[model samples]
Target: MSNNFKGGRGRRKERGPRTNDQIRIPECRLMSDEEQYGVVSIDKAREIAEELGVDLIEIAPTAKPPVVKLMDYGKFKYEQQKKAAEAKKKQAKVQLKEIQLRPNIEAHDLETKLKKAYKFLENGDKVKFVMQFRGREMAYKDMGKEKFESILAGVCEEASAAIESPIKMMGNRIITIVAPVKKK
Candidate 1:
């Protein structure tokens, strides 16, 4: 299916630049408050900001009209920080970890490797268990593949394959990825 398909239809038509939420002000904004330099003069604006005890934030520029607002700059900054912190807390951090093994791995070796992977998963990290083959080990590719699957099962409830197993032809490294279980 096409990636841009919308409800089985083609991509939607292009739209013009979206309107901004900021309220626009006339270029000669300062003149209304008490004429001076085009829009409200800088001096008068400063006076207004001081009177209202809020900042005269410039909201828009470059357009035929420019805009400014009277608001608490500190409060605005504080709210923005709050929103950012909330977004950060809502995000989930995923990390990748690696475990190496030799083709002639013994039962204890496998168990140790499995323990390391379990620790990684419990800590929210994915494990990429690599089975490196030496000279004769390459001839028995099935052994490595079988061992990889066995390791996957060993971490059963804690992890799952992130991608299809990848076998590298470089010298003799067989790599596979096992992703951590998503936290509930």
Candidate 2:
């Protein structure tokens, strides 16, 4: 028998600033919110941070002399998380909405599906049109393609939609993806 499981230690951990007692460099370039302290011994920097009731955080450990800063580590982390949250809130998530149809769909049903696809595009959701062929219906691939193209053209003309993926066959189904055009 062979064991294929790997230990969790093989995974890489996120790197963060070394704060307070975790900073072990003997000397480093120190900076504070008010001014820069040039190059100074770690003990001197720690003394200044301790006098100001702030933590000594190593910001650039890869620098020639290492760069440390005197700041409230908790406050710094909070501000970083707040910025990240703000960015995430401003980002838009595009969802994919799939609409299934058949090659022999009636004109009225096709119109309804097109209307639904337009609504999806207006709401900033991508649309995927899929038509599956059954048995003998697969022989008329050109008809399926024509139907898919006609529906897509109608939807694109009605709404400001652009094709993200062209019509392609997946197994027994023909599918295409469309997305809303970005406003300048």
Q: For each candidate, give its TM-score against the true structure.
A: 0.61, 0.84
**Per-residue lDDT for 100 in model 2?**
95
Q: Pick the TM-score winner.
A: 2
Per-residue lDDT of model 1, residues 52-118, tens digit only = 6666555444544454555666765687689999999999787778899887899997888788888
Worst 10 residues of 1 by lDDT: 15-24
The residue-by-residue lDDT of candidate 2 on 1-184, one tens digit each, is: 5595565866545467778877788899999999999999999998999899999888889998999988998998998899999999999999999999998889899888888988999999999989989989899989888978988888887898899997899989999999999988
How high is the CA lDDT of each candidate model?
Answer: 0.63, 0.89
158, model 1: CA deviation in Å?
5.0
Candidate with top lDDT is 2
User: What TM-score would you give candidate 1 relative to the actual structure?
Assistant: 0.61
Position 126, candidate 1: lDDT = 70
